[model samples]
Target: MNHNLMDSTINEAQCLMQALQSAGFAAYLVGGAVRDLLLGRVPKDFDIATAALPDQVIAVCRSRGWSIIDKLGKNFGVTAVIVKGVTLEVATFRRECYGEDAHRPEQVWYGTSLKEDLARRDFTINAMALSLQGDIIDPFGGQQDLARQLIRTVGNPKERFQEDALRMFRACRFAAQLGFIVDEAALVALSEFHTRVRGLALERVRDEISLTLIADQPDVGLGILVHAGLILEECRIKVQGVYHPVPLLSELGDLVDVPQNPAYHVHDVWRHTLAAVQAVPPKLVLRWAALLHDVAKGRQGVRGQNQAGQPTDHGHDRQGAVLAEKMLKRLDLPARFRTRVVWLVLNHMRFHMNFNSVLDGQGLTSLKHWVREEARSGLFRTAEEMHEAFDQLAVLCAADAKATGRQFGHEHEREKFLLILADILQSMPVHSRELRLVVDDIFQEETERRLIGPCLKGLLLRVQDGMLSNERQELTVAARKWLKKHKQL
Candidate 1:
């Protein structure tokens, strides 16, 4: 059990530990809970490893009238208990043997040895545990590995990976999530074993990559994945007449060596893309846009100079949306996310498109006029269409600009651009939610459903932007207009 009484893991937790002891079984809070605690990070949840069998653990929960989730059962040796409002996982010590399917262990047997249990774990940092009395368990030098900020297999790296190939992927994930280095031996094992993931489910692989993307330094994790041959195969590229392990879009692998206008981007497209991805706040939509924003810069890669004789990646924003669609569709990501990510990619360059004249030190057109002009031109749209999404794009653009080693042109130019951009974003209008009630009252249920979905949302946005009024007469007129435009009238 987690011995810390003050950090929300006391009371019933203590009782459970005491209960296990009273039953003549040893119980200790193990796995991630103990490791994170030792690292001075708050553990998300607590798990306990005990000498008690699955049946005994289930019995204990019943005696206390606690809820139980015993779904894992003998297959994985895991069960849960709701004790005094907190849910704790209770698992038995076991050594696993994997069959041909790497995901499922072929057979399992419970033992009283916590040492053996920790030994079977994939990583040393995760293998460490804590006793109820707070004595540190460091049988495999897990503490030493933790101190060195390394992720290493508990025993022989090759054997451990052979037991379960998924551990190789897990190694990359832990390195990314924890910002730790993979031990040299572990990295070698991963390079040799990455091909084992070829048969793994796409959803499972995608999920792990998703977690890594949102971590502190996603690009670092990505770089590690590439080095491990994890990214080459996905890229659909061949080196030495064999497939390379490229994760995500193959276009990303192409971006690695693609050149850019030296005046705008100091590094190549891939480096700049990574910088942009790292610069964003790690939101799913924004990060995806940031990573994909400049991907088409290579294809639409600067056809020629604009009228001002400056380098431009003409049509890249549009082309990127198409390419991004292909990537997301192949991955079978959520439909809602697919819609928003593609939208963000399409519009990512518009921020600079409108501000190019102002940013080039030519004119200080009044902010009010710019906002109004942009709204009328659909440069800025409804609250739902633009507000949160545009906010993300604006931040992404800032990251894009700052990716230049010298920080986006001269110091004064960068500051001025960012300030004006901020004001423009802040000045955008919001749709009147009150208009939804009006929409409902004015239209039939069937009509209301259609209107509320898109037609009304558009009307409300126009009303907020001053193109129409929120009053009943004007909203009804606008709805009729939208239906007519769609030929649904």
Candidate 2:
């Protein structure tokens, strides 16, 4: 293995190593940090593997006047140290064994050899380690795999996967994240051992899938998972519309290309969803929602006769929302994230429907009505919430439409929708500006007096609703009467 460390990372790791060695314990930079440094990527976090046990690491840190945060748990070994706000994870070199396909090594055997530790890792590229003295330890040929841009199991793929099924998904996620390819042998093993993923925890699987969705090339990762037949096996869920004959996006190879399609979508819900997921910013919750938004389109799309005998997915958004909720729940995502995702999926079709209806000037009134109704119902009342929802929804809808391969008859219709979305985004008031108002001074001024007090705030909340319900005029009259009775004027 090559052992030329990036100067900056080496300095960081050496600082920790010196601290440990001064207290008489062996320590070395290890795992992903070493791999990243070799690849010239800034490592997200640095980790040190020490021959000293977890307790010993704490003692070394305490002797150096450093605060140690023991974050270790059963079946996992870790201790964190904070130095100038940067955290470094220090773990003992240990070997693990699988008990019943759920957890590794019902008992752990701490080892003094770095080779032993590297041999027990999940992937070849992740098994390499770097020493404080700048020595590279690659008993597993991890450097070769790194050079090849391949994700290969550390040792026996079957045994490694059986030890922890989550590694299977991690392999795919790393490939996606790093733009690497899964080793052919590893891919073959993934196909045969895909069922092992069922043994992993839901949250673990959710995280890996989320990472894959946010990758620069998410489709590559998803395609590998689908080709290996591991999506259903690992996810423990079935795609609703995997077999549908949908149109394909013409500019599929282009980066961030979102073509407009109006006919039957060629990509199944899963593939279209992967494309949509790729279109959004790499936000965890938003990407997850994007990937799962149209999961029900395949199951709910009917071969019904439109005026022209074309197929339509009339209520797929509502059905897709239900499916998204179920998938999110199974993964134990936070309740708030689950709710927001389901809401986005449920309403994803609304804007597109509005676009189609309002392509002609005749439907603008109906579009406005729908927008007002949504606002009054508090579906998207706050500017921030509305912006976030619309941004994600637009991306999902555009990807869905593009995957269909049909173009809108009127080019201006699609441009109008884009214009509307841009207008919505710009219409949002900055919260900081809103917060800068001097309420006391405003209340004393006649022009701003109407904005004061809880009554006024409460009225504002209900104002739009009242107008939509045709009660605004009545409420205005009642308010004047009440003010006169109080003699405020």
Candidate 3:
């Protein structure tokens, strides 16, 4: 640990520790902060575990005028305090029991020793702690596991997992986050206790899944989850074999060396998706789209031949959208995000189809119509919104096309489509034109005199055909005669 980084913050932590020591209570910096410092990573948050009771810790914070946010209602046995704009969490060393392998102990025994407390932690890497004065505490050889870049349970893996089934998912999440390998013993335990994860709450499972998906090398985490049989247990979705097509996006700025598969793809789906996601400016909606763009490929894939004797996943985009919706809903995702993801999934293949069909035939007119009439109709409100959608769609499509490993056959066709899309994107206005109505003209002579009644439809048809000028007086006279004859308003 760097002593220079431990300045006033160390003093503050030490002050808290000194107060506890003066009151005859032991305290230490625990969990992620300790782990991160050892790994030379900047800790996002700091935590403390102490022999003092929660009430005593609260009293100490109150004496210092620190604001404490209690999470005891959530059964976390933790409280967060803000000091000099930095939030620190403090928890009491305690023992817990789970009767059914899902919920926490119905009762907790507080004032436990640090070794006993460390034994209760989910993983050895997280079980270690550090003193305010830079002393390391390792009751379970967590330091050894940390040095080995291994994730192992503090005690019996099965027992740790049975205590809280969500810990299984957390194990995967931590491995993904830190780029560590799960120990063989832990992996075997995970395989055996996989079914226990089904007993966990959906929100807990969903949160861990999200974290794993967004990790530095998400595929590693996901591969472990699948190998351990936890995905089927937690997700209730059966994947027949290993060739699943859904790719997890890696975290930003993480260098991943993805193996090239030159026969069918320039890059694997995982790396392609990661690159595609990075190409788009980061937005929740766009990122979700990029991540789920090809979800249907695995399900819709055909091994042998179609009617035309060619391998095909026809209508995969539509099928993928359906699958994406189901997956997102299962995770309890927001409606707005679900809708955007579905939209992207459904239209991911559109650009390819347009480029192949229209751009190669004659000119850019059909492509333009596709954009203006079909794509712009309800997909976006403003032209700028349409451009953003198009740009993200292009990135996803290009990645998908690149994954196909075909040359696309027509260089002019591809160039034209790209150029036209770029031109439209650059010139597109930022806002849509508002619909304006001449209220007075409609309400006065024409409407009042019953000139704009049902019978006026034919007259309006004539006006649209240029037989009558659209001037108020001309419309009023035409509407009056039609309404009088119809005897209706």
Candidate 4:
């Protein structure tokens, strides 16, 4: 490991450490920063641990013209200092005693040695420290464990977990985020200590789970949670941190082993879903959508099998949307966010249908017929522009295809179609006063309200396709035929 930290952000913390050391108090860069530095990953935050008491630490900050983070009790022995526009967190070397519930430390005592302080941490990898002179302090062999790609506790796994049960989830989170493995002892301890994991605040649990879901390899973390018997603990997570019956994702029980047809999906339902999730760039929305995209597969109530005889999650798109709505609602996500995710889930399957139907043939021909169909179809329902709608759908399809051991292809042709489509739409004045007159002349006031949404936009798309002229007479005839066909008259 290069003792010299490569990142410039560490300089702020280094200055604090040097100041503490010069003042005859033992100080070093500690926790995650040390671990990430040795791994050559630039840490987002820098923290310093020192033998200086919290009062002494506050005094040093005041003497050095740095502002304390707050009134100071918010973080126990930990304090945040802002120096030269960079925030550095400084903590005193301390030992803590946990209450029987193990949610947080009940009492804390300062003036502890660095060795004792390091021993109190959650994981071996994070227990290591780096001094101002570039020396590493890793009495628990964190460096070796890091090289081995392992997640282990500072001492007896059971004892560590007993002190802070959230450590069990943290272990899985670390495994997921860093692509590491939990040590056998830790896993066993987690299994024995599973109940303690439920004592944590549901919001905190949700936040941790959310972080794991967004990690590079969420499956690793989730698999550990399952193996450690911590999966069911999800039910104890109160809805939005305070609702009863805890609407949990754990409700999607045994989805991993759900069977799928070999022809399209060689893997089981769980594997396929996870594969889709992993295929997408780690956006929370995309990953969450991918995870729940096919959740209804193989369930007794859901429609199954397509016309082709392959196992079909026939109405899974809509079914999964319902489930997603329920789960996200229970988790207390933003209303707009939940609506969008459900919308994406509901339309995920056919978003590419219109263009795809014509892909092998006249996809670029004219948008006129499709728009007319939308105007004529009483069920026409789309928000925003068709182009943006298709864009999101295309991304969903790509993720779905990737999960099934396939690719969404015919790429070059699709690119060409989009280029042509863009040009055609740009040239059309579908919203012109001329077109407005045609609409006014054809449809009733009630019917016009509906057209203002999907119907009107649908016609605009058609006009771009050259199927309908931008002229009043041409649009009038098209509008009458559309309204009459759909019984809007």
lDDT of each: 0.72, 0.66, 0.66, 0.73
Candidate 2 per-residue C-alpha lDDT over 1-489 given as tens digits, one digit per residue, 9 for 90 to 100: 344583557464677788878877788788898888888888998988888777777777777677777556424567888765578888888877778644345668787788888888899888887766677888888889888988899878888877887888888889888889998888888889877766555556767767887887777787777667666653333348432221111111221222212355555445566666677667776677667665554352422346865545568678778777776766667887888788878887787777777675666666655544555554553656756766666666765566554554555667777687556344333222222233453245564455345434434444433331224355445444444444454
- Ranked candidates, highest lDDT first: 4, 1, 2, 3
- The per-residue C-alpha lDDT of model 1 at residue 65 equals 82
Better of 1 and 4 by TM-score: 4
TM-score of 2: 0.78
lDDT (tens digit, per residue) of candidate 4 on 1-489:
445563343567877887788788999888998898888888978888898877788788788998887755734688888987898888888888888755688888885689988988999899988877677899999999999999999999999999887788888889989999899999889989888865676676677777887899987887776657776665345456573545346645557688787777778887887777777777777767777778777777674676777676677787788889998887777886676667678777654554575576754443535443433333323322444434555576677876788545667856765665455434444243324444556656785557545556666767655676666676667766666676644
C-alpha-based local distance difference test score of model 4: 0.73
Candidate 3 weakest ten by summed lDDT: 246-255
Which is superior by lDDT, 2 or 3? 2
lDDT (Cα, tens digit) per residue for candidate 1, span 1-489: 334522434566667777787888898777777778878887788888998988888887788788887566666778888888888888898888877654567888886699998988888888877776777787888778889999989888988887776677677777767889998998898788766666455566777777777878777777677667775544223458764443555577767866667767788878888888888887777888888887787673545666766556788888888888888876778876887788778876766665566776664454445555545555333644555665666677777777765454466765677677566545445444546345554456564466556776677567545576556776777776666676455
RMSD of each: 6.6, 7.7, 8.2, 6.2
Clashing pairs in 4: 305-312, 367-465, 368-462
Candidate 1 error regions (>4 Å): 1-12, 234-248, 300-313, 360-382, 409-489
Residues 1-489, candidate 3: write the lDDT tens digits: 545434424456666666777778788888877788778787777788998777888888788878777655425567677765667778889888777636456566774688878888888889887866667888888889988999999888888888887888888888878889998988988889877765565666767877776666565676676667676654332247422222222221121232333444565445665555544443556656766665544342512345655344567678768877887776678986687678777888777777677655754565655564533356566666677667767766765665455565455656677887777455433322311223344446644544333434465345434466546577666655655666552
